[model samples]
Target: MRVFGMQHIGFTVPHLEEAVRFFEAAFGAVTCLETGRIEADDAFMQRRLGVPAGCRIENIKVLRIGNGTNLELFQYSGEEDGEEPLKRNSQSGGFHLAFEVDDCHSAADRLRQAGVDVLEGPTFVDAGAMQGLTWLYLRAPWGQFLELVSMNGALGYERAGGPKQWSPVTGE
Candidate 1:
């Protein structure tokens, strides 16, 4: 079978409750499922999650933002070890999750006012129809990378005789 769109994006955090608060306060995300301690070191954990033996995955939470995407956030505390947390987008395997915003500059200001470390804001493009697009990158308190993009009006493809990008609104 062919794959559709994304179902969710999962990541483990140092603090589960704090991450929940951040998602709620920052992106207006609501909790869909709140799981209690899930201590397991058996085959289920090892086979399904690769959570090796002598380890425990206690607190787990799931949050949903706009669109149909879900963020599966987990807090790990156990004997099995993992690498230390790194800065936002610090390595080749690092990536940032982006969200669509109505306005870039204003959102950047709002994030700055919220005490988030603003990496860059309103990095506009100087090209064809993409001139209207604006992007901003910001970092969470826990060092997770996030990006903001505003896609409106006609873009480069549309101007170049190409079809517009698929969106929930236009459904093109």
Candidate 2:
């Protein structure tokens, strides 16, 4: 057996309201569900969630962005909470969620106008396998890395009859 498709991607944030608001404004994310505070004074937090005992989960929310995976936003409070800064791309386990757009340049401009921290270009790939692709990186209000990408027509591989990559734009 094998996995079918991504159900959701979850990440803990320092502030749930700020995160939800940022996602909604930035990506037009829709809030699908929310939960009240969840806390336990025993090993449940440790055994089930691998967190320190007596930790409290302040809130949880699920958001739908475009047609991609549902985003699970979590806010927790405990001794270990906020102990580390957000990781950069150069660090291990560093990752960013990419949103496919029809026009990378326009999207990046809009993001910049909205006061989002956009980094550098919607860089164009002029050669190699990624030719015809454009991408830009930006940071969410809570420091999560995000990307905007666009593929102009077909890429080098797709032009050669390679398997088309799945996209929210094409739903392939």
Candidate 3:
């Protein structure tokens, strides 16, 4: 089976307010949803995912980071049991998540000025079709690796620089 597209990327945070504020300052994302109960909304996810009963799930905020893509943040009550956020090489294997930006340099500057750790970049990625593309990596306040790509390139299920072409196969 072929996968369609990414629905959303989820992150578990200790505090919702702080995470929300950081994202707002860094990416200009606005709060789209704030819910307290995961179980009430989806009992299957709650039960199957091992989300404890009565867990204080707050501020399931969705930010429109790119075209038809969203960044979903979840703030669970109490301390985080997982590895510390922002430690790129920590026990948590997941390295980073990227967002498309109009201008990577400006975005990096904004993030740096806002006290977010600008790890690297605003550098070029020579991906053949698109040269001189700029991108940078930053550590979100919650320690998640956020990549800002500054290039006018199409992504996901669509070809870069032009319309997509589909091919059909014949059954023998």
C-alpha TM-score for every candidate = 0.85, 0.93, 0.68
Give the C-alpha lDDT of model 1: 0.78
Q: Which ten contiguous residues of candidate 1 have the minimum total lDDT?
A: 163-172
**lDDT (C-alpha) at residue 84 in model 1:** 64
**Model 2 worst lDDT run, 10 consecutive residues:** 77-86
Q: Give the lDDT ranking, best first.
A: 2, 1, 3
- Off by more than 4 A, model 2: 80-83
Instruction: Kindly report which residue pairs in candidate 3 clash with one another.
Output: 85-143, 86-143
Residue-level error in angstroms, candidate 1, position 26:
0.9
Model 3, poorest ten-residue lDDT window? 163-172
RMSD versus native structure for model 2: 1.5
Clashes of each: 0, 0, 2
TM-score of 3: 0.68
lDDT of 1 by residue, 6-103 (tens): 77899888778888898898889998987888856578778988876756677778888876568999887764434666544767779898887788
- Give the lDDT of residue 18 in candidate 3: 84
Q: Model 2, residue 162: what's the lDDT?
A: 89
lDDT of 1 at 40: 61
Query: Which pairs clash inside model 1?
Result: none
